[model samples]
Target chain A: MTATLTQLIPLTPPANPQLQDIRTQAAAYLQEETIPTNKNEEWRFTNLAPLLAQTFAAPNQQLPPVNINGLVIPEAPDSRLVFVNGIYAAEYSSIANLPAGVFVGNLAAATDAGLTVTNYLGKQPGGEEVFTAINTAGINDAAVVWLTKDSSYESPIQLLFIATVDDAAVAIQPRTLIVMEAGSSATLVQEYLHTSIPNHPYFSNSVTEIWLGDTAMLNHTRIQDEDITAIHIGKTAVSQSQHSSYTGNSIDLGSKLSRHNWEIFQIGAQTETNLNGLAMVNGEQESDTHSVIALTKPHGVTNQLHKCIVDDRAHAIFNGKVFVPQAAQQTNAGQLNRNLLLSPTARIDTKPQLEITADNVKCSHGATVSQLEDDEIFYLQSRGLDVETAKILLINAFAVEIIDRIPVASVREKLAVAVKAFKAS
Target chain B: MINPNSPVILSIENLTANVDDTQILNGLNLEIKAGEIHAIMGPNGSGKSTLSKVLAGHPAYTVTGGKVTYKGENLFDLEPQDRARSGVFLAFQYPLEIPGVSNLDFLRVAYNSRQKHLGLEELDVFDFDELVQAKLDIVKMNPAFLSRSVNEGFSGGEKKRNEILQMAILQPSLAILDETDSGLDIDALKIVANGVNQLSNKDNSMLVITHYQRLLDYIIPDFVHVMANGQILTSGGKELALELEAKGYDWVTEPQPVG
Candidate 1:
């Protein structure tokens, strides 16, 4: 690692002793790790040169005055957690009316509640990865969500992360750890956003780890809509127990360059997982999504659909892996990556990998990259729609399949509007 | 319904077209006046579908020769969408299942486009809903289908009914039915044909292209034309459809001795 990049890693002692051990271990591991480049197989299609060349300072301590008029989700009016540049903003948060057996707070509040988060925090596999290690080593505070055994939270919990760069390029590592106990159920909406500022750039590295216990269910919706000048890299690691259900809907809309690594591991039998993701990019932006679903037990079921709409000269890359070992006999897994290139220069690289060792398992994977169909366009034209409107309608149709699955009504409507307004140019 | 005094709605003279380097329409000639219903019957590979596609301005088909005039104006002057907005409609044999586009939305947009082209005020959601509901009874379609994707997961009969419903909504001057009865059952054909019959008037015209005399039973036409090798070979009354059905296409397509 370059000395300049190494100097950016924060080694400040955590205020709470509970994080000292993990921080030290992660910091030691960070020394041996370096920022990944195109040489890395996982990052072959994503060039990190821009991110590596620019220097990033620590997050600003003084929060900026902002207007979040439209950033709030109505469904979670009283259960929202707001963070600015990775630091918890208590004044902007509303934590009232939460049900019993639920704890939603920052790391300091968790310590006060006598919550033992270390048992599940940073415990998911892939903690040794470079960016993950960097986030772990620099952990000062995190958004923590904990649901006790058999607890049910009817309303969705919102975690909003906002970033701003007024002067220098700042870097922030936002951490989220969600633990759902046995038979518990809850819905979560995590959003990463930034103001519409041009030329001013920032870097955001985020890590989220979720644990679902036996018979638990979780509905997770993650949205990344930062400014076009920002660089973002995020990881979401999930572990599912027996009979647990996990459904994730992720949308990537804004960023100059971004990479998202989503990994899921089924540790027990009869687990169910459904993942749907859409990455819509334009301009000269680049977006990469890498996902892995590893099944270790029998009778596991997983279905994944990841789509990308590349417009202008933007580029999109998707690599989805599904592993079904011998122990995962009778596993049913389906993975499909569908991409739409709106312009001649727009590019999409998709790879669907299925490693099946069990003969009895039913697993299927496929990838398709296509532009608009002439027949479809002509069909719409025959119905009185002009060529431009027909293309927009078809593009919206391609995205609505994933957007409609979002559980939150406001989010779905907002995304639908954005998708409708998108143009190829 | 034929009226000699009525203005000519469509006139096709020696229209030659090709799709993917293969000539599909070979100097085809046809003319239809307002308030008239014409039925064109032909055997397989006779360019029946190609003629409709060319009239609708499908991009894959290139016009190599001849010209088509609609409402006394050259039809080729307008784009496909403009042709549709100007009252030319084609009911596809295989309706596309456009997933994620609601039937109601598609109908509203299409109806509004035609309304705008006619310099009429566009209907809002509420008003369009009321109008579409009244039109739904024409085809006896369930209102639940309006909320679903356009033609998606619809049965063959439902798709044909949907096409007829579109024709009823558009109220086109020159409506072309391109094998509309190809995938329908006996019951579906009756319902679809009944819808088309209800929409027919002295101000509009229809060109029904079919392979069977069965659809003609429900939608009786003023003129019936037999087509061969991409051109119309004979023109007769409605009984011509019955003769073709009974005697088969062999009698018409067979080479006659020099006479």
Candidate 2:
């Protein structure tokens, strides 16, 4: 593990002095930290033995040629930044449609804006975690979006990461930083995908940090659709200021084994946070989602709904935590986790926790694990649909509740098709 | 609408059924001619709903004995969906609330299945929408219901109206109303009955199952039967429904002196 960590850090330091300092500190932190095992409480349901057994080298900087037409979302055609193997691909990126005071480009480009980014780069909490530290230790470039005060972009801005693996196993660490100044608003879509048809095994470790200023609103959508043979571990950390609103939508559908860590902290009062997540796994795939919502001030509002559909021998795990301390009076929070098992052998472990110390707060949480109801299937069958069609309709209905909330039209249509194709193996 | 010359549309001979190891239907016998509406009045636990479910091929009920023929074909031989496509319709007492499935799409798919069974070309979205809009007027349903999920969050009156709207679209040869008027008010009952009356024709038959006689004032059945212990205790003209209403369920279950 030590040898693999050394190979991930680039020998040549970045030109930006601020990033160089971050890298050196992250390297020293890694000497004391190690990869987490199943014995850890946070990773009890997720075994990383498959990931730790193999050694992975950093991907080369050379960009491979591939068709990206299918990955395009027509709603955000002109404001897109494409990254290949954690490196920015300039030939495929377009920023002609962005308005003034909106910066959409790589970290190197954000460095030219003079110290505006340094205040938020690698500044979010939870940087000491092993995977996040690994990403910071090898941080060379990142996808950065900086919205100035009172600047609003009408269309969505897309950040797409494509991983292409060759014969040898490789590791790629992707980083993203989004900063919304006071009264600024924008819609952002972040997607991760693999280009290889029969993909070679690879590891993708990624970290994303978002900061919302006072009264700012941001709609964020994250999609992870790596290859079936890959391993993906991701972290999304968010900080919201006074009266700011943040909505996040996450869809996970790929990887043989994957885990997502979502954390949200309310730094000011009267902030609102909404989160929706869906994970669909079949065959031998395993997926886990761990989320934490912390409210420190009064009058904060938060709602979270996460669902999973497991089929065949697949497994899914979910652990969600919501904290309302003594200072957070009059806070309203709700959390729910719903899971569907399509096969008898499919497994789901869901735990929803609420820690409330404030007497004046309203909080509720529940978790449900269920199979397709016989009554539902018979109801559809009685309306002239066969059993197979009935099963598909019910499954699609279960998933459409989350998919329909997506703001993008083409993305919703694409996911609807993928959901309809789900069948028990 | 009953005529002696019309052929028998449905015939049930000593039908026996069970649900969850308990017998619900015990040797029930009935026959209906074409263009006739027959009303069955019974007390609770008399297997009135079970009879409808068994006829619709619900998975929970198993037919332990006897036989039922629909238009000269064995009803139990076909699967539930095939039976539906072959002109059998059951308006449930409690319609299912399927979230996220649009009402218009569900109607179109069910209608297309019947059309396909009859060897007719299927209608596209525009034509089907036009047809469904015309049918919606029969039940006095608002066009907004088409966009909402099927029966989800609908009031009792709205759900019953939606069921009648489906009946207007399917136009089945044999329709079974399993306590359709259970939860509806008088106004909604009239609307549902009006929709059913419009769909009734010389080639179709209906079996209306209910506990009250108020629904009969609007529907006006050609025949009424008193059911007790899963068997037809007595059969008579439409006046039987009024008599049952006046005498209550005790008159049917009591042992009367020979007369």
Best by DockQ: 1
The i-RMS of candidate 2 is 0.9
Candidate 1 lDDT over residue span B167-196, tens digit each: 889999999999999978898989999999
TM-score per prediction, in order, is 0.94, 0.95
lDDT of 1 by residue, A224-329 (tens): 9888889999999999999999999989998899989999999989999999999999998999999999999999999999999999999999999999999999
DockQ of each: 0.79, 0.69
Candidate 2 per-residue lDDT over residues A1-425, each given as its tens digit? 36666777777777676788788888889988778888899999998877877878888878877678889788887789999989899888888667888889998888886537778878888788888889998898999999999999988999999988878888989999999999999999899898975668889999999999999999998999899999999999999999999999999998988999999999999999999999999998999999999999999999999999999999999999999999999999999999999999999989898999999998999998888888887877777888888888878888898888888888889888888777744
Q: Alpha carbon lDDT of residue A253, candidate 2?
A: 92
Candidate 1 residues lying further than 4 Å off, grouped into runs, are: B21-23, B124-126, B246-255
- What is the docking quality class of candidate 1? medium
